[model samples]
Target: MDGTLIVGVDGSGAALRALDWAADEAVRGGFPLRIVHASGWEWYEGHEPSFGINRDVVRAQA
Candidate 1:
């Protein structure tokens, strides 16, 4: 089974803080971190989030 940490971000300082923490946790654990930004509904006529680029398993620190 695979583990993951999902964080929601919106280009704010607080969101960045959460992202930083999430990144650290992912580095501590052998799990993947998924950062998702609700790409705004205005441009949602037909848009799909990038699946392969930003999605990868991160190795824990040794």
Candidate 2:
């Protein structure tokens, strides 16, 4: 945890490219690579909660 490389992923093509670059940098720098997937939809007051919506589904989409 001393030297970690954090990469934000959103299940997008651009994110995949960044993840690849971060992985290589992590390896060369001898640091741990941490992948973080996040969503703000759950926190937005304007977001409507439907019957099928859940944290798992949101996380999977991230």
Candidate 3:
């Protein structure tokens, strides 16, 4: 959307590879890059809130 390059990624190897590919494509197209991810199992069981979590923090931790 909005001519942006959006990509989804999980913790798996293939997902990471796809993310890298998307980043390259975004750079080549001169488009902004966006990452979109969804929780697969945490909705059923959770600890506290992720209210203040930041994207960079999550990425570094991952």
Candidate 4:
């Protein structure tokens, strides 16, 4: 592939599994891995106290 391997992660078990699979594929295919996390709290009506904190933790783990 000519493009990068993009993976979406939400700090969940499923997202982590997908990330690991994507990373493996990226390594085998020689593609750059891009991990993305979207916090939709800003667009939502209610507040999420763990939104920002979770992003920080995810970033550190990444």
Tens-place lDDT digits, model 2, residues 1-62: 46789999876889889999999999988999999985565465665666546878665665
Worst 10 residues of 2 by lDDT: 38-47
Query: Any residue pairs clashing in model 4, and if so which?
Result: none
Q: Candidate 1 lDDT, tens digit per residue, 2-56? A: 5898998876889899999999988888679999874445544554565532334
TM-score to native of every candidate shown = 0.57, 0.62, 0.63, 0.63
List, in order, the clash count of every candidate structure: 0, 0, 0, 0
Candidate 4 lDDT, tens digit per residue, 1-62? 88899999877899999999999999999999999986555544554666545677645755
Segments in model 1 whose C-alpha atoms lie over 4 Å from true places:
39-62
lDDT of model number 2: 0.80
Which pairs of residues collide in candidate 3? none
Question: Which of 2 and 4 is the better model by lDDT?
Answer: 4
For each candidate, the alpha-carbon lDDT, in order, equals: 0.70, 0.80, 0.77, 0.81
Model 1 lDDT, residue 49, Cα: 62
Put the candidates in lDDT order, highest first: 4, 2, 3, 1
TM-score, ranked from best to worst: 4, 3, 2, 1
- Compose the digit string of candidate 3's lDDT tens values, residues 2-61: 599988886678888999999999988898998987556764365445765565966674
Candidate 1 residue 36 Cα shift, in angstroms, is 0.4
TM-score of 2: 0.62
Model 3: worst 10 consecutive residues (lDDT sum):
43-52
> RMSD (Cα, Å) of candidate 1?
9.8
